[model samples]
Every structure is written in C-alpha cells, then in structure tokens.
Target: MGTADTFIKNRLDERKASGIYRMLKPENSLVDFCSNDYLGFARSAMLKNNIVAEMAHYPDSLNGSTGSRLLSGNLKYAEELEQQIAIFHEAEAGLLFNSGYDANVGLFSSLPQKGHAIICDELIHASIIDGARLSHANRYTFRHNDLESLEGKLKQAKGNCYVVIESVYSMDGDTPPILGILQLTERYNANLIVDEAHAVGLYPAGLISELGLQNRIFARIVTFGKALGCHGAVVLGSNLLREYLINFARSFVYTTAASFHQLASVKMAYELLKEVDDEANVLRNYIFLFKQKLNNNSQYKLLPSDSAIQCIVVNSNGNAKHVSGQLQAAGLDVRAILSPTVATGTERIRICMHSFNTLEQVKLLTSTLNTITHAQ
Candidate 1:
C-alpha cells in the first residue's frame, strides 16, 4: 500500500496502545442513555405522518437533491424551512446547511479575513477548531469558559476579531458564562458566534433568546439533530450576513439542499416543542432525580449542569470503557467518552437524558454504576 496509508495505520496502532481506539456498534434494543434524541421526536409517529403528508404534496420529493444548490438542488422547501427557522429564532434571516459541522466549517473558514484574528474557547467543538485551522486569520485559544483569558486575547487582536464558543460544552456538560463573554465582546468590538448544537431544543428557548443576547451576537448556529429529532442545521444572523454566506460559504453553495421530507420533519419537531409540555417536563424531572442520586453516591461525581447532558468523570479511558461495557451488559446504553475525544485526564462516561426514559430506568442505571465502581 501507499506510504500515506502505512502512516495512518501506524497512528491507529498508537491510539490502540494508548487505550483510545474507537469503533461503532450496531444499534441495540437496550434502554437508551446515549442518543442525542432528547425529545424522542426521532421515532415519533406524528412526525413521520407529517413528513409523509408533506412529501405527498411534492410527489418528486425523494432520495436526493440532483446536484449542488448552486446547480439544481435548491428546492422550494429549503427556502421555506429557512423562513420558519428565522421566525422561530427571532432573527433577521436563517440559512440552512446540511449539518452543524458543515455550517461551522463554512462560516469560520470564510468569514474572517487575512489580517483579522479568531479568539476561541479551548474546549469548543472539533468542527469549530478544524474550521479555524483553515481560516486565514491568526487564531488563538483562550482558557475554557474563562472570560478573563478571552479578554486578554481580545486586547492583543490587531484587526477585526471574532470570539467563538459553545452554549453547552459536549464533553463536560457545563455552560459558559455568556453574559460576561458578551460584555468582553462588546468592549473589544469583536463579533461573537455561539454554537447552540446541544442547547437548541432543550433550553426554555435558545440561550441567546432566553438571555436576551440575540442582538449582541453576530451569529448563532442551531442544529435540528439534537432536541429537534431531525437532520440538518441553520445559521441565524442578520440579513446582510445571510446574503454574505449565500454567496461565499462554500459548504452551503456546493452541497445539495436537504430533501423536502427532512425539512417537513424539522418543522413538525418545532411544533411539538411548543405543544408537548408533559413529555418535556418528565425528562426535566428525571434529570433532577438522576443528579440527586449521583450526588448521594460518594464514589461518583456529576458535573454542574441544568441541561440534558451529564458526565461522570472516570479519569482513565480503560476504566471508563470498562464501566460502560458493564452497564451495557446490564441492559443500559450509556456511552464512554474516551481520551482524545475529551482531554486525557478528564475521560468520562456521557449520559444523555431523554424524555422517553423512565424513572426506574434512570435509577437502575445509576445504581448499577454505583455497584460497578464501588466493587473496584
């Protein structure tokens, strides 16, 4: 084989040696504590029916968009979905992207010019980091969620500056101090971008809307895959920004638009978010009880979070993987967040709470976890 292939295989071997090799498992019928389908809309019959009905209206809506959006893939439903998202999020406009990763890479790689700078949180998502790496701007990382470090970096920026962060950290299950970060962004006259992938459907509203910071941020990226229980993502911004991305964002321009069925499901998920109070409340209560149980256990420590994600820090990757495997054997479906995915010293087992998960299931899994750790 090629030398490049050999180099990649050697790297894989090194990862295996460090106990951080990764693999995907087939879907199991076990109780789920690992999926991002927080609202359980992914499997909803009502959503399925809505998508079917919408597709019937456009008989040609099927399999794929023929080509890139700039060519033939731009469908009427794509524009309709963008309008719905902008109205729901109270933004001037919204632009649809195939996924959150595409949206981040396109925005970060294209927006900031050569002399400008990007100051981002160290713990931001990998897609954001990859986008920044491809950018022409000089990039620097501030301490995770530390506004003081961000401000220090802001003072050193030579040109137009952008401060990037996430509303909720994926690995740590914690939120940043947004108000303080906004204050610094304003003081330094820098644009602010918040990736709300994990917070979109779970929060009372989105972080920007709930905190009344929508006007302050230059852009916000929201995904449908998490709480919305669908595919695709949108970038909410001013009309001028929307126009800019339409012309300049390569990811949006080159990719075929999402199909009509996907757009219809996204719309239905938002409708459910407004109407389904009981289901949402049940999930919230389970989260509260789960946290209380973890607090009572001396061996396990839960991170500080009011969102749907929770993490139990198990410092070693091998140990975290071992605990997760035991939980799976006992019929729970929790996932281990391995090193390299998370920082080496902070490897964890990520438990995603869902609206469909029962109280007994939560208690059983946590108790099983307690038993496993205490046994060691």
Candidate 2:
C-alpha cells in the first residue's frame, strides 16, 4: 500500500483501539429521543406545506444559487429574508451563512485581529474553536459558565477583547448565566458574541430576545437547523458588523450561497415558529416529565439542563455505548456520545426532547433508561 494509505489505516486502527471510532448509522423507526427537532418542526407536515407554498413566490426554474452572494447568487429575496429575521430578533441587521458552522467559523475567524484577544467558554462548540484557531487573535478559554474565570481572562486580554459563548451548551445542555457574563463583559468593555443555535426556537426568537438583551449584545448567531428545523444560520448585529462580515468573512464570501428553496425553508420556519409558540411550552413540559420520572432513580447521573437537550454521564466510552445499545434494542433512539466528542471520562447519552413526544413516551423512556442504567 501507499505510505499515505498505510498512515490512514494506522490512525483508524488507533481510534478503534481507543473505543472512540465513529460510523454513520441510517435513521431507524425507533421512538424519537435523539434528534434536535425540539419543536417537532422537522417532522411537521404543516411546516413542509408552508415551505412549499413560500417557494412558489420565487422563480420555479431556479435549482441552485449560481454562485456566492458576491457573485450571481445575490438575490433580493435573500436580503429581504435577512431583514425580516433581524426584525424578529430585534437586531439592527443580519447576514446569512450556509450553515451554523459557516456562520461561526466566518464570524470568529474574521472579526478579531492580531493584538486582539478571543476568549471563549471551555465548552464552546467545535466550530467556534476552529474559527478561533484560524484567526490571528490571542485565544484563551475560561472555565465553563464561570464568570470569575471569564473576568480573569478579560483582565489579561490585550486589545479588542471578544467573549464567545453558546446560549445553550450543545453537549451538557446547560446554559451559562448570560446576564452575569454580559455585565462582566460590559465592565471590561469586551464584545460579547452569543451562538443561540440550540436556544432559537425553544426561546422566542432566542434567549437574548426573550430576556430583552438584543440591543445589548455585540453579536448573536441564530441557527435554523436545530429548533427551527431548517438549513442555514444568520449572524445578527449592527449594520457595520454585517457589512464587515460580508466583506471579510471568507466562509460567506467564498462558498456558493444556499439555494432558493433552502432560503424559503428558513423563511417559512420562522413564520411557523411565530404561529406555534406554544410548542416550546409543550417541549419544556416533556423535559420536566423526563426529569421528574428519573429524579428518584439514582442509577444514572443526569446533567442539569433546562433546555431541550438532556444528557446523562456514563463516565466511560464503553459503558456509554453499552447503555445506548441497551436503550436502542428496546426501540429507543437514544445515542451514546463518546470521546473525543466530549471529554474522555465524560462519555454520555444525549437525549433530545421534542414537542411531539407523548407523555407515555417520556415515561417509557425514563423507565427504560432506569432499567438499563441499573443493570450497568
């Protein structure tokens, strides 16, 4: 075999030995407990119909965005949709990116410069970490959700400090004390950037808008894939920030824009979110039900989270996989998140609660989890 092929095989073997090798599995007909469709919009027939209707307003012949926005891809509909979304979120302006990863990588990689500092929560998403690594800014990580640690990092920051965090942490499913962090960042005159991917539809517009902090934030990244059940993301801020990213963010400037249908999906999703705000409440109640059911059972260590994403620590990759397998065998779709997706000893089963999930389903899931965990 070639040298490069042999090296790849060796690496794959190493990953297999560590119990952290990865593989893609097809979707199953198991009970729904492993998706990010918090409001069930992804599976909603109504939502699909709305998207189809909205797409009718655009050119029927258009199959794709011909090029990047700066090229032939720029369309009036796209710009108008951005404005509508920004208005809903109470932001002065917004710029769309092809995906949440693109939005994060573009924003972080371009916004901060040399002699500047980029500080993030230790538990920030991988995309943000990658973006920060690509930038020239000096980078530091505060302890997860620790304002004091964040303050210390800010104090040592040299120039143009930017603090990054997720409104809802993706893995642990917990949230930081955003108000406290905002106040601290204000004190240090640092720009606060929030990625509200997991919190968008679960909280009206997002947690920032729900708290009336839209005017105070320097930038907010809202994704459509999770709660909104759509396919792109937008970075909302002042017009100047939008313009800067339009010109400087390589991810936005270099890639082909999302197609007309994709953009229509985003637009229709937002409209559906407005009409079905009660879905969030139903999802939250399910979250409570699951927690209450498992509360008295001490077999599994449930992570503290008020968000749609719920997690239970299994401590080791093997144990997590085994527990997830047990749940799956019972026709539950719960999956194990092994390291290095999370830390080595912090492998877990990440459960996602959705509005469409029934009370009986929640009960069965909790009971099944308890049984499986007790056996472990």
Model 1, runs deviating above 4 Å = 295-298, 374-376
Q: TM-score per candidate, in order?
A: 0.96, 0.98
Candidate with maximal TM-score: 2
**Tens digit per residue, CA lDDT, model 1, 1-376:** 8999999999999988987788878999999999988888888888778777767777867677777777888877788778878888888899988899999999998898899999999999998998888889999899999888998899999798999999988877689999999999999999999999988766745888878888889999998888888988899999999989999988888887776667778877787777767777888898888887764566556778888899988777877888899999999999989878888878788999998898899999878876876225
Quantify how close model 1 is to the true structure by its C-alpha RMSD in Å: 1.6
lDDT of 1: 0.85
Residue 161 deviation, candidate 2, in Å? 0.5
Q: Which pairs clash in the backbone of model 2? A: none
Candidate 2 lDDT by residue in tens digits, 267-347:
989988897658888988898888888855565688999999999998888889898999889888999999999998788
Per-model CA lDDT versus the true structure: 0.85, 0.91
RMSD of model 2, in Å? 1.1
